[model samples]
Structure formats: structure tokens, C-alpha cells
Target: MGSCIICGTDVEGDGRICRSHQEDVVFDFRGNSPDQLVANRFYRGVVDGYADFGVFVDLAPGVTGLLHRSELDVRLESLEWEPGDDVFVQVTGVRDNGNIDLAWSIRQADREFRGELVHDGDSEWLPTDQADETEATDTAVETEPVEATSETEQTETAPTETEPTETADEPEPTETASEPETTETASEPETESAVEAAAEPADSVTASDERVTVASLGDRVDETVRLEGEVVSVRQTGGPTIFELRDETGVVDAAAFVEPGVRAYPDVVVGDAIRLDGEVERRRGDLQVETEALAVLAGDDADAVETRLAEALTAEARPEGLQPLAGDEAVAGLGEGLLDAAEAIRRAVLESRPIVVRHPATADGYVAGAALERAVLPLIDDAHEQSDAAYHYFTRRPTDEPVYGMDAATNDATRMLQDRDRHDEKLPLFVLVGIGSTTESADGLDLLSVYDVEAVVVDAAVADAETRAQVDTLVSPTLESVDADLSTGALVSSLASAVNDAVRSDLVHLPAVSYWAETPDRYVTLARDAGYDRERIAELREAVALEAYYQSYQDKRELIDDLLFDDGGDLAAHVSAQFREKLETERETASANLVTESVDGVEFAVLDTDAYTHRYDFPPTPLLLDDLHRHHANGDAAATVGIGTDELYVRSTGDLSVRSVASRTAEIAPEADVSTAGRREGKISFLAGERDAVEDAVVAAIADAF
Candidate 1:
């Protein structure tokens, strides 16, 4: 033994250097076992070559180590050491190829040792000659066993660590470690942020936007709401999927994302009713719901949706918390009373006869008062009705008529006279004329005398002069053998003045005897014959014939008496003698011309009855046409009177250029005195041709009357 050369220590045995410094050291005999000598020095060398060819390393200066590649731990492949790079080497064995076998387990052993030193905070021996000798001496007794255990452990553990490290090292370990961690950490935040963002309130989410439903994606929505409506259309786009839902309010679009690995149903079409739940989201400046779930519901579901909408609208329309007043008994009672009054009036108008009934002058004046009393009195007797207040006067006037007189003081006198004439004298006449002058026009002058006769002699004569004149002129010409007496001025004035009074007061005064005929003789005869006892006609005829014949004879005798008898004492006998002589001559002539039904044999005679004798005393009732013209010319209110099968028509002559009042059916007699005091006032005003004013006045009058 000698001192080692690498790291100096005392050497021993066969004149060789120590293992720490065994440069150029070898055994003496060529075929001898080298295991007898202990190799001390471990050299630091480069891996010169690697493969099954062997791991060649410099060992002991010039002596080379040829370690088998298979014997090396596979984990060392990650070291990437090339030629001339330093690595710890040791002598493992003497190979048959005459090369020293080397080991690099010292490098791994050093890493383990350093790790242990760091973890345990311990210092151990460095790889020097003195330390190696000391370590060898300490482990000398167990060296072979320790060495075998290390080899076995290395063989087993190295294979596993080597495979993964080897694959990672082919790229770069630092680059590989950084790439995956970056991706995974970045992706995790995105998922978490999405859930947090979707947790917002619905109002905030839907503000200023429209929501569309995305079918079958309900799970993705954090807050899903329901939309019930009819499906207007479903469409598939190559790039994306969308559908349209329509309700009465409006239409909205539904959209969804096509997930991978899911099959799409293409046959789904439009007009399907569905209920959908979805998230409202923003798309292209509009709020749209991304649908999560969609279901095809029955038609009743759509009906339910509509019902809900209608209920909402109805709720909006109702006034908040308002209710009707309770327990208004008085108001209810009043309403019932009004309804009863209206029913009574309707019944009266329907059931009443055509005759003009006179109103009593004392308590119930005016025909309307009488009619109303008649209608309501029975109801009152039953104890189920009550009467409203009634105002009394001789005649009733429409309220719209102008209030005449200098003042209230002057009105009493005029009204008194009017009342006296209307009730006491029964002389008030209302002449409704159509297209004529005044009621006293020449064509119907004698009308006044007839009305006066009817009024004074027969009592209570109210006539319409205009209607009489129309009969004498237009109606009379159409009838056979009728004559009209048109000359009589005093009678005309009296009748005209009476009619004017009624017109001014807006009162319709009807006559007791209404005589209207198509022929002139019929007009006069009807007037005279009315109220005459038809049973006494034969006696009355003989009286009239004798009186007429005597009067005629007296007229001729008066002419002879005026010339021959200065004193008129024998005039009556002379008249009787002259009447006999004329009768004898007329009888013989009549007998010669007589045939069995001879018309010529009949003696034509004029009557000297009370009607003919006192005809000049009474004013005639005016005709309808004449009254209309008088009112029209004098700018007074007038109406046309026409009789229908069931009712009387009193039309205003104010705006009527046609000059006739027409019934619902046939044309009526223009001369007929159908005028009644209770009739409504005409629209015509005292001032003519003021149609607009008159219309307003008429409407006012009707309202007041009702």
C-alpha cells in the first residue's frame, strides 16, 4: 500500500495506490481475479458514449470504464449529459473485455444525500481520500450487502420515474408545466363569473329590452319565467336556430344554441300553441328571452292566457274601490211615479175616441186636463197612484208661445177676455190654414155666419175658418150638385178675429160640430144638418118648403105692393094669394114632364129654416188652408190639420211649401176642422220664414208640453 494520488491518504497492499487515487493502478497477473484488490478512488469523468455498446467513461486516469448500458438507471436519460460534461464515476467491476466497469450511482446518491442534509440539517463526509477511507472502514463489514440492495432498488424504481420524465423532456418540462396550469385556471374563472352575472333580478334584466324564449334550454337559465302564447313560426337557420311567438299584444323571437352531440328535430312547424320558460337576455339592442323549456299545450291553455289578459284589462278599467250609494228610497219612489205617469199618457192616447172632448171651465180647464183626469182618476181610486199639480185656465197654451201684454198687470185683462171667449161664449176658433190668405178670404166668407149660427143658436160653436174656405173652393168643385155662398163680410170678420186670438195664445180651439165635405152644397148642408133630428126630417122638409115658397111669393108681392098699395096692410094676403097662383102653375108644368123616376118632376126649393134665416149672424169656422195662409201672411204660428183612419195630423205650415198636412195613409179633406185645443203647437212662429228660430221654438214647445 501507498498514499492515494487524487485526494491523498495512506495507501496499503501490493505496492498499489489507495482507491481514492488509483490512477494507472492494476493487478499483476493477467488471468488473476482483480477482486482481491480494493479499488478506492472514484473519478469524475464525462459520458463518452452510451448504448448497448457500453457506457464508456475515464476511470483511474488513462484506464477507461465500459459499463453496460442496461445496468444504468433509465432515469438518467433525462440528464441529457454529452461528451466532456463532468459526472461522478466509480469502479463497479472488472469486465472480461479488459476495461474497468464504472458506475454513476454516486450522482443520485449525492442528490439523496443533499436532500437528507437539507431536510435533517446534517453535515456528512465530503468525497475526499481521508473521508472515503473513513467511510469504507465504517461500512467495511456490511459493504457487500449495502451494494447489492442499492442495485436492486435502482433497477425497480428507475423504470417508473424514467418513462414519464423521458416523455416530458422530449419537449420542455418548464414550458409544459406552465401551459396546462394557465389554461385550467383561466377557464375556471369564466364559468364562475357567468353564474354570478346571471343572478341579477328580473326587472333589472328585462329593463328596456324584449325577451325571447329559447326552447329546451331551461337548465342553462338562472331565472326562468313563463311566456304563454301561440307559436307563429319556427324556422331553422344554417348558422343559428330561431322561432317566433305571437300574442294579441305583439310578437317575439325565440332562439337557442345547438349543443354538440344532440339531434335536432326539423319537422317542427308553425302555429303550435306552447308554454315556454326562458331567461330574458339582450340581443342586438332588444331584450329577448333565451328559452330553456318549451311544451306544446292544449288549446285551453291559450284560452286561459287570453282570459288572464282580459281580467287584467278589466281590472285596469274599474275605478279603484268605488261603490254605489245604498238605501235611496225616495229616488226610487220618484222614478216609479214617473214611469207610471208615462204609461198612463200612452194608454190614454191609444184608447181615446176621435171626438173632441171639452174641458170644464171650473177646476179642469182645457181638453188635455179632462183627458188626463179621465186617465188618472181610475188609478187614483185604486189607491196606487198620486196626482201632480194642475194649473187651470179656460184654454191651455203651449209654453213656447210668446208671453204678450205690456206687463203682468195687462196680461190679466187679455187673459180674462180670452178665457171668457173660450169657455163662456164657446166662440174661440183656431184656423190652421195651408196656402191661402187670411181665414176670412172671399172664397169662404160665409164660413163665419155658419159658425156663428152653430155657436149662438145651437150653443158652443168653435170653428176653423181656413178649413171652411178650403172646403168651399177646392173640395166642393169635385162633388156633384154642391153650392157654396162666398159673400158675407161681417161673418168673416168675426170668425177671423176669433181664430187670431187662438193663434196668438197658441191654443187650439176645436168646434163642437166639425163639418167637412167635398162638395159646396155638402159643405153647407152638412153644417146646417148637424145636430138636426133626422126622425123629424119629413115634417121639417114640409115646413122649409112652405116657408121658402111663401118668402118668394112675398118677394114678388112686395114689388107689386110697393107700386100699387101705398100702405102695406094687405101685403100678407097678397103674398099668400101670389104663392097659390105660382104653386098651381108649377104643379101643372111638373105633371106634364113627369116620368116614373123623373128628375125634372122634383121641385127645387130653397130653405127658410132657422139656419138660413139666421145664417148672417154667426161667423163661419175657418178652413185649414185659410188658417195656414192667415198665420203665414201675418207671420203667425199655423198648422195643417188632416185626419187619418186612427189619428189627427197637425203639421206646422211654417216650413211646409207643399201647403198640406198628410196622413200616414190616404189624403185627407183639406177643409176638415180636425183642429183640437189640446193639440201640440206648430213649429211656425209669429214671424214667418224664420225657420231655424221656429224649429228651436217648436222643440222647446214639445219638451214643455211633454
Candidate 2:
């Protein structure tokens, strides 16, 4: 009913593609049935393994077919193929014995396909041909070699007549019999397709007699054991298929190989509860089960496993209470909600689901995301037995804008889809720390919603009304009507503490480090008690702010971690010195260029932004204006405006909305061509010729509105 996301083709089922482009598109093949692959279609395949007979190409997980040597146009050894190299192929046929036949394709590169690749959850480009191929059953008619020789005997009997040479005719049958090993070697590939075909989706089945827990697998080395649980992940090596199977007790890897690079059990997928029988054994140093059989369990037996996991998880996942570091009651009340949110993240780690922390590319955003990362990573390591679990489980990404825009959403979608398709990995829990609020992020959230990706928002910005419906959890002071100037870092630091109470001491200085100026009294008290002096807090703040401005979009992970957490204060001191130098120089120059005027008892300090300030430099106009407003407050009568030809940025000691000023200008100087639209970043626009009138009206409006 809908159009394809790519190619805009009118599609029938699932809005995927039309019949023509389907053959051209590459898919993350979920091996369901051999019939799902259309007849005589080309596919993109990964080189699985090679044998003296031929090469094996993996079309999808648990689904591999063979390319016999005769099917190649050139010698197999001369093809220059390595394991895992992606190549193009054509399905020649599917054997009734449950095997696939592949032919060497002339167009071997992915770029040869004109259609877009439909990658992700399961359809692999497998072509289904008729079960039987063209049979030339005319049967090579041959005369008995003895009869031809007997004709020579008859000629001998004739005594004088000459007979044709029967010797040449006698060798013809031998040549036909020894023509090539092609036909004999063709059936040898069925050895790699040894597993039984799985045709129907099974519902819950009775446990096999050999069933045992994964924890007991190590004890049963060399013994046949049947284990049942969900398929946590599936990975195909050049040699064997490694399936990470997790039962309630623990997780163990089961290695299955019909042949090198061939999918062992084509029907099993991630998230499918399965019962498998394998021989327990050790390879290298780790224990792995040599799988003999695996079946995808369905129905109530599958539901039973999931329900048990859910019940066990839900019990341990919920937090006991709220813990507030801040003394304010409003913050304390919100702390309870933060605890619940923290538990969600902690549970994701325990459940082996990935966590993605998205924050704005500012000092506050970085500190917030880094704080959560610092807290959650250790938990991931403790929860999973693998050393790489921490890296795989936790990710902290810095977004350019403070809103969840389409770009960020698209990036997350693309990565998650690939993981799900290739590795059988689960979707990530999006922990939107500072960058997800307001109606501007609705479209971005809608995209994630399509795949059911969950999000957690912790911010201190004024939230849009629609933002609540978009997120699973929204933690913001403004949303609760708590008029506190807490930064996002400060709020998330509290949540991070609730995530791991042991990391509380490590984050003592983070809240204070998030504030650029006028550090909150509560945070200052906490930082002082944690042994960080006023000078150290300022150094951390300025250092991070300087770093935040330079690469703005990058995570700057290890460097930021060392800056904020290193016991030695050298990094912070060095960076903070340069930070203060640049900011102070810009401030002094901006002050020198300031033009002062007052209208109706209101003061206005207007600076030509393009000339006075280094617009491209550190301390962006907003930060610069904040410094200017604080530094030039001689009884604070009105506001300071940084005027550019295209726009003006305003900062006032009193309550200010530039919209009010633009509205007044429209009435007074309607011919001035002044407008207030597209000014969300606290800036307004006006005509260059109407400067005097716009300024006059702005001053008058500020005087009247405030």
C-alpha cells in the first residue's frame, strides 16, 4: 500500500519493493525457507570457506550453499577469494536433499546492483530454482566394444575383405566415462547441508531428556547435553557458527558446523527460545558446545521462558527509594523519579541490551553523558563475563544540537538495524541526557518509535508540551514547575549516582564542573565537602567548556575523562589557563566596542557583533553576552544587545523576550521591515537601514514589557 523508502516503487507486501528490484536488492537474510528465494536470482554473498572441491558462500546465517568447481568460469584457486569477502552469485538450483546450488556470477561487485540494499532483519538474497534441472536423458547410444572387435573377427573370417578399425571405436566409451569428475563431485557438496530441514514454526514442546542448564555445561565435557534458552546472539566465523545461548543460570557459546562457513542451524534466530543438543567440549581455553541439533521452540514453552525472565528481571530492576544530594525539596521529589530511570539503564546492562547515551555537544552535555558512562560501564563489566562487554554495552554519543533531530535519529537507526541484521544483537536503550526535549524532536522520536527503540530523557531545559508523550521517561525541573537553574549535568549526576551508589564519590566534583559562572550554592557546598577547592571547580568547568567548543561534535572521550577525573590536576590547570585567556580577551574587546543608550529610563548596551566580537572564536555570542550582562551591571536598568546586520542577540538583567520588542517595532516602524521569526536562539532580525528605529523600539519595548 505504501511506497518504498528507496526507489519509490509501488509495493505489495510490507512496502519493500516490486518483483524486479527484489532481485537487485541485498538483504540481511533470515534463513526461513529455501522457497523464499526466487528462482534464478543473483545475490550478494560472503565467502565462507574453501575446499579442494570448491568454495562455500554464506548467503545468510545458518544458510549456505556450495559453488562446485565446474560452475566457475575460471579455476577456483585463480579466483583470488578470501574468507568474508563479499561477492555476487546466482542460485543455480536447490537440491531435494535440502542443499543450495550457487553459480559464479560475472558481476561480482555490490556496486553492479542498481537497486538499494534492503539490509537488516532477515531477507537474504537467495534465489530459488526448480528442484530439478534440465535432464538430457537421451542416453549416449553406444555399440559394445566387443561387438566392434567381433566385426574385425568376422572380417578375419571373410579372409580377404578389409574391415574398419574397431580399435578407435572401442576407446570412445572409455573417453565418455572419464570425461570429467564434474558429475561425481556435484553430489559431494550435500555433505555441508547435513542438517534436517525446519519447515514449520514450532510452538512450545516438551523438554528433551538430555536437557541441562548452561551452568552445568562445563561439568558435562564430552557428554551430550541439551540446553534451552533464548538465542542471545549468532556469529558466523570462517570456520564454525558461534551461538551465544543464555539460560537463567548463565550463558555459554555453542559451536555448530555442517562445514566451514556453512550455517549450522538455519532456522534459529536471536530472541527465539530454543532447545539444542550438543556435545560439551573445550577449544583453546574456553568451553564450547559442539552442536548436534538445534530447534526453534515455539508456543507456551517459549512464552514460559520469556515470562520467567521478565518476572526475575522486573523484581530486581526497580529501585527501592529516592536519594537526593541537593537539599531542596523540589529536587528531592524529582530524585525519586530519577532513581526509577537509573534502574532502567542498570537493568538494560544486566539484560545484555546496549545503552546509547546521547547528549548535547556542550560542557554541560559532555559532563552529563560522561558521568552516566562512568557509572554504567563498570556495571556492564560486572554483569557480563566477557571483557569486551563494557565496550559493546555502553556508548556515549555527542550530538551537535540540543534537540533530537532527524540526523541523530537516522544515525541511530542505521547502526541498530545493521546490528540486528548481521549479529542478532538487540536494540539499544537510548538515554537522551540533554538533547531530547521540545516539539522539535518529535520527528526524530517518531523514527525511533517505528522500531520500538526506548528513550530516557534527563534535561533541565524548558520542555515542549508534546515532549512528554514522545519519551518513556522525562526528567526535567521545568516540567515539574521547579524553577531551579540546575544544569543538565547536575541533574544527570544525581541520576548517575542512583545508577551506581559506589560511583557517587567519583562524581562529587562533576556537578560543580558543569556550571560556567555563578555556580549554584548547593553544588558549591557539595564540591567543597568533597575536597575540591573553589579554584579547582572553576578550572574543571573552564577546561571542559574550552574543549567542548573546539571539536563540539566529537565525544573526546578519553581526554574528557582524564580532564574531569584524573587525580593529578595538571590537565585541568593547563587547559583552564588557555580557556580564561581567550574568553577574557574577547570580553575586553567587546566592552571597548560597546555603544550605550537609554530610552524611557531603560538602559541599552548595543555592540556591533560582526566588528566587536570574534564571531568564529570560542565563547559563542550567548556565552559572551552572559559575561557582558554580568560584567556591565551598574544597577542593571535594561539589557545588552549584540547587533549584526542579519540578526541581533540580546541578554537582559530583567525578564526578556525579544518577541515583545519585535512586536512593538511592527506597530511603531511598520515600514522598517522588522521581523521576529526564525529567532529561537535568543536573537532578532531587522533591516540594516532601520537600525535606529529598531533599537529605539526594542528599548521602549523592554522598558514597557519588563
Candidate 3:
């Protein structure tokens, strides 16, 4: 029996937590076999890898479990767990074949649990002070008797080894005779030479004016090298102060130590140009400079280093040309804007600045963001020596709304500011894909602009002058002479290729996957040539759309990659099947409930969404309306409207501004307070009390507008 770590109640079967407190205390499994796992007990584990069906977690070395997707509280793709991420899960069962099944725990962090214990095979152990005390006591007991016995033996053996009468006298006489000669011959001259050898190198290195680039450090390991560069980042670790130094060719970490956990060169900070003298040595298979002497470079020296870095970064960042994939004329017409956006992104990567991508939570937006991600990630890996550089340098954040609103802006601002203060990271460049080209995103853009953060908008939306003026770089075909119908995915796929042309083959099929209907002939050919058939393309699109709907605000990077690029195609097929089943059911329900009316010469199909459909489920209001409109319109001028308890959506076959309709409806039903409030697909909100009145007025308003 053992006492509970939290409540001090006695536990059974050598467990540290009582049955009542098991749920409150998280256990750290130390056992090597699955049989030691207790069902319904939460244990800390590391994410090993992901499978199509589940995530594999390693609770201990050789003890792994499957956390199936069905057991997850959220969608499998929505989980942000990467390989080696620490996660908490409950052991559901240990099968006869040595397979362990696990379930998700809502309490993921260490602080959320009341207490923690280490569970060994037969017993549970306290984690900290009590465990340490037990270990110390056992070590002391085993060593104390041996230490005393050895001391006693030494004392008894000393006299026997030396006969004091003869040996002690003989040794003293010889020592007196040879001491003077030995000291004269061996002590003074050698001491002075050794002292000079050490002092000379220290003085020479401190005063040396020679400088070497960061790229050349690998060749000069174990040798003193002087580096002149700007400090890009600074981190004070428990042992040494690490400064990321960047020169013309590359970046390297230089560690300066005053003492253990002490800050060295406290006055030096990020962006300060300095001359560092250190010995290049390998730590954990990476080259690091053990800083010996550091001094801030001044005047001409600092300016020269800064200038070299700037020129090198600029030259490396700018692409030579913007070649359209498949020679599409529309993409070529917007080449200048795409070129500028690409240059900014590449420059940010080279400067060690982070890139934050903000896109809508939709299939088209995801494809656009994923395309840029597929291109930029490889460039990041090639540019930085750090293994985890991709995580730090790039991030994709999906917004719940179609525009970059204040909520997303605030979250971004708070996160960036915290990173800057805590980790000394550079401010990230904001890349807005499929989301930032409208007036709705202006306030978010303005918030970012106040900090002088650069924002690049790559969208197919028609940008007004205000939206164009707010962003640093805008890539929109509508701004140019090209009037071709381009999906945001198609537009961004070209921009992604410009960012990194080496990944051109990977982006070939992305444009087709983004289009819901009317895919361009060239893109279809491009995708087919890339080995993705029409059926395969549809499966990929449906898979992404379903995943995007469930966790609309999360960037499901790994899962999306599998669906879009994996050759197995099983995951896509499975997910697409779910998409079809759910969509068909909703379509059937919506069609049966829909009511058609003729206002003047216009036709309208309206559904009472609140009463007839699953309002909170998949195929959201906007998506459902789009499908309904397409089926009813049949290439004719018709509109589908979904009227909910408080909100409504409008989808049309011809030109109509929901904004203009909302204005007219406000005049007809002044008490309803009608206003546009949702996605790019038109949505309006009104008081619940005036549902009938608002519906009648909106019908009249639509008839007048049509």
C-alpha cells in the first residue's frame, strides 16, 4: 500500500494515488510493458507518430499505445501535437496481444493536474523530494561501512609498507640532497615557459583584428576564430549565454559564459554588431563558438558588416523571374505583384524573421496556404542549420471568418509581442492569403501597421483602393487588366512557385484541388499530367473541405499534407466518403423543406434553416446555401436564401450585393436591424422577434434588386 500523493489516503496495489484521487493525479509511466498500465488512469506520453486511423504515443521506452481518432474529443487533424510532443492520455485497455488502447484527456498540461507520480512495474514512486531522500539513504547505507573499513585497512597497512627505522631515514637523506638540485633544474624555468605559452595566446587573441565569416566556422573547429557580425538573437540558458550571430554567408550560435547560468556581455543585445573571438567546437554534432572575448564593433567596422549582410540577403531573396505554370496569361499579367510578395517572404526567411500566414477557414483558403507552406518550408530548412527551424520560422493560422478581423489580429499581436520579449525573436511578416483583400480586414491591417510589421496580401478578391493602400504588397488579378476567373488557390499556387521554384512540381495539382466548380482546362491538364486523375482530385477536395469544416480555426498541417499529397489515397477516400454521406443527407433535408416563390419576374428558393436543417453541424449555412443555389439555378438567374432564427445567407446565380440588399431591407423593416455579418458569401442578421417581417422585407428587397 502507498499514500496518495494528493490527499494522503492509503492506496492499494502499490499505487501512489488512491482510487478517489486517480483522476486528479497524472502518472508518469516508468514500466517497460503494457500490463503495468492501469485502465482509466491518465499517464504522460510522447507523441511517436501519426497514422491514418490514430496517433501512436510512447508512454515509456518499448511501451506504446494507440489513441484512435474516434476516441478524440476533437477532430484528429485539429490536434497540434507534433512528433515528440508531450501529451497526456488515459489508458483504456491493454489487449492480450500487447497492444494498448488510449483515450484523450482534456487536462493536457502539467499544472492542470493536482499531483504527479512515477509508476514503476510493481510500485509507484514520488517524483521529487521523497524519492531523492530514499535514494540518498540507500546509497549512504551501502557505502558508509565500506568507507570506514577501507580507512582502517589503510592505517594498518601504512606501517607494514614502510620500515620506519631504515626506510624513513634513507628517504630523508636522499630527499635533502636532491631537493635543491631538482628545484633548480625542474621548477623555475619550466613554470615561466608554461605561463608565457598560455598568456601569449590569450593576449594575442584579445588584441587580434582578424575577422572570419560565420560560413567559414565549420572549417576552423578547435581553432581560435574572430567573427564580425550582428547578433540576431540572444538567449540566457542555465549554463551559458547563447547569441545567434549572422554574417554575410550564414548564422551560427556563439555561447559566452561568465559563470554557470550567468549572463555574459550583458550590454550586448539583438541587432548589435560586434566582434567575437572564440574557439569553434562541436556540441551535439553542431558547430558552436565558445566565446573568449567579445567587443561591440563601432563606426566603420559595424557599418561594413551590416551593409554586407543586407546586400547578401537582398541578392539571395529576389527571384530572377516569375514564370507562370502552364504559361497561363492571367498569372503572368500579375507577375509584378507576385514577385514583390515572393521577395518579401524570402527576405524574411533569410533575416531570421518569422512568417505568419492568415487564411480563411475554407478549402480554397487552405489550399492556397498549404501551397505557400509547401514551397517555403524547404527553403527554410536549407537556410537554417537548426533542425526545428521550420516550426520557428513559419506558422499558418486559419481565421474563423473570411476576413482578418480584430480577434485574429489581437491574438497575433499578443503572441508576437510575447515571443519578442521572451525569446528575442524578430517580428514576423504577415502573409494574408485568400482573406485580406476586403474592407472588412482594414482594421486588422491597420493594427499590424502600427508596429511597422510588413503584410502581404495574395488574394483573388477585388481589392478596393483602401484595401490595396493598407497592405505593403498586394497580388490581385483584378487590379490588373486580366479579367479571367481565378480561384484564390490558383492565384496563390503561382505565387508559391515564385517563392520557391524548386517545388514547382509539388504545386502543379494544387490549383485543381482548390476549385469547387469550373476548373480551368489548363489546371485540369496540369493536374492530370502530375498523375492526379479527376476522381482523385475530387476526393482530395472533399477531404480537405470536410477537415476544414470540423476544425475550421486550426491549421491541420500534417493531415492536410497526407490528403493532398499522399500516394496511398485511402485516407482521402475514407474522409471523402464521410463528406458525401453528410452532405447528401443535409441536401435531402434542405431540398424537401425549401419553398420557391416568384417575386415579379425573379425566382427565389428559401429554406427556414433553423427548423429544417442541422444548424450546428457540418455543411455550414454558407456551404449549404451554395449547393442549393447551384442545383436550383441551373445556369439561370436565380437566388437561394437560407433564413435562420436570427441570421440569413444569400447565394445567387447573377450579380447581387448582399450588402445592397441589406440596406434596402433595413428601409422596408426598420425594426429588424438588418446588417451583413458573416462570410464572403453574403449573410445578414436581424432580431428574432421580426423573423417573419424581416423575411418578407428581404424577399421584397431581393425582387427590387434583381
Candidate No. with top lDDT: 3
lDDT (10s digit) by residue, model 2, range 544-646:
8888888676666667888888648998999999988998999999988888877777778888888888888888776788678788634454788877766
**Candidate 1 overall lDDT versus native:** 0.30
Q: Write the per-residue lDDT of candidate 3 for residues 592-695, one digit (tens) a residue.
A: 98888889988888899998889889888777788878775434547888999998988877778888889999999999988877536688889999999999
Q: What is the TM-score of candidate 1?
A: 0.15
Model 3 error, position 265 (Å)? 1.9
Which sections of candidate 3 miss by over 4 Å? 1-210, 216-224, 281-287, 479-484, 632-637
lDDT at residue 365 of model 2 (Cα atoms): 84
**Over the stretch 362-429, how does candidate 1's per-residue lDDT look in tens digits?**
10112222222233333222211011111120122211111111232133234444434322212222
Q: How far off is residue 6 in model 1, in Å?
A: 99
Q: TM-score per candidate, in order?
A: 0.15, 0.66, 0.74
Candidate achieving higher TM-score, 1 or 2: 2
> Judged by lDDT against the true structure, how good is candidate 3?
0.77
Worst window of 10 by summed lDDT in candidate 2: 151-160
Worst 10 residues of 3 by lDDT: 151-160
